[model samples]
Target: MEYQWNFAPIFAHSDALLVGALGTLRIFVVCLLLGLSLGLLVGLARYSTRRLLTWPAAAFVEFFRNTPVLVQIIWFFFALPILVPFEISPMTAAVLGISLNSAAFSAEIFRGGIQSIEPGQWEAGRAIGMSYAQIMRRIILPQAIRRMLPALTNRGIEIFKMSTLASVVAYVELLHQGRLIASLNFNPIETYTVIAVAFFLFLYPLVRATYVLERRLGRSD
Candidate 1:
């Protein structure tokens, strides 16, 4: 027996899907900004000579990197409210988990990019009477960032997919909305297919961009 494919029901709930897409985009943007920004600070700490900074930063990176992101999200949503004074909403929990997880990963990318620079670069900056901060801001980061572009782009793509995990906590992302449509219309096939297509449509260009960035960076180097 062939499964009769029906999409009309899914189309009927287009408004819900649109809302879900918006929710997804919101979480993705928030996580991307917070993650990469925090990652830079954590990466700088990890790269520091001081043990005080390195120790805590190292622990954070290790903890997040070693643990599963899904668990992080669940813990933040379910367990954190007990310890904190304020309530942890689905958006807040999703943001905290995904952002911190991405931060741990991006920190390594930032650290490696910075370390890939030659020692002579630092020496040259010092010879020019530049302070550590000045050298990093003006010289090192500029060069390192170019090399890190592809990796960072890939990380952004990953963050976009990670937004779906928010659905587990009923955060009303694309997948969450799809689930609602599936359960109601009893058409999981058509519902999930649309969701998959939506994801592919959104992510394909980014995947292509990552390849382009790699090629350009390759030629530059």
Candidate 2:
């Protein structure tokens, strides 16, 4: 006997999936913003000559980069609440874990992008009487950003996928909703398949965009 496929039951719970998708988007946006912005600061610190700044930044990058993101999420959700006065919500824990992990990885990307510029570009800016901040803003970052687009896009896609991990802590997301629907309807196969298709639909465009960016940058470079 062959397995019978039915998607009608899953469709009946579309509202749950919509709620899960909203949760996923909420987390993704917050994490991406925090991660990239903080990463810029951390990357600059890592690149600095001052030991005061460099040491802590280096330690942060290493710790977050080396450890598993899942462990970080669990730690924030369970362990940190024990240490702190306030309650740690699932959203807060997920945001902290994903954002920090992304910051560590993105810090390296930003640092590498900044460093790739020729030293003469810095000297030229200094000769023109530009301050360090002015030089970075006017001369360096604009160029580096173009080079970093593909990598950053890839990071964004990674963050999107990482949103699913929130379900581990019972944070509602696409996978979490799918699990609920599956359990209720006894249609794990169809439910999970829909979830997978949803992810592919979300990520495929990003993947294509990365390729396009790479090609355009290649031509411009």
Candidate 3:
């Protein structure tokens, strides 16, 4: 069967698609901020001298890193309420799930960046009587963060793509909105094509940014 090509349906609901796209972007931004903050803390904790602190952070990173994000999202959306008897909106659950899952992977990225710094840098900081926190905050973290920017931007693209999974929990992100339009119009091709274009529009800039930063850093190195 030949499919008829029609972009009009997608354009007809551009307002709704825009709303959903904005919602997806909002979730992505919030989750990225929260995840990056939590990842930094967890990364530091994993490097702590205390085994108690380090072990928990290690466990968290391992568990989330090893598991699929879709499974984690399902657990948060479906199982959490059953286990804890507390209600969370689907959007909230989606954001929290994505943030928490992203945190684990990002923690490892941060840890790698931190470890890649030369031992001499740490010794230099300590030689100057810098406290551990001061050393990390002032010297190590700044350099590590700059080094990790490309990886972090890549993760941002991943998170934006993963935001589509929010539809599973009934959060009306772009994919969800597209699916709704497809269902109503019986035009899956156009709906999905638009969704794909929208996703590319969102992710391509981050990819370019990553490339630019990587080149800049490589030049300096």
lDDT of each: 0.94, 0.93, 0.88
TM-score of predicted model 1? 0.94
C-alpha RMSD between model 2 and the true structure: 1.5
How much is 187 displaced in model 1, in angstroms? 0.6
Model 1: per-residue Cα lDDT over 1-221, one tens digit each: 98888899999999999999999989999999999999999999999999999999999999999998889999999999999899999999999999999999999999999999999999999999999999999989988988898889889989999999998889989999999999999999999999999999988987887788677767855
Candidate 1 segments exceeding 4 Å error? 209-221
Q: List the residue pairs that clash in candidate 3.
A: none
lDDT, candidate 1, at 216: 75
Clashes of 3: 0
Highest-TM-score candidate: 2
Q: lDDT tens string, model 2, 42-148?
A: 99899888999999999999999999889999999999999999999999999999999999999999999999999999999999999999999899988888888
Supply candidate 3's per-residue lDDT for 197.
Answer: 89
Of candidates 3 and 1, the better by TM-score? 1
Q: What TM-score do all the candidates reach, one by one?
A: 0.94, 0.95, 0.93
After TM-score superposition, the amount by which residue 121's alpha carbon in candidate 3 deviates from its true location, in angstroms, is: 0.9
When summed lDDT is taken over every stretch of 10 residues in candidate 3, the lowest stretch is 212-221
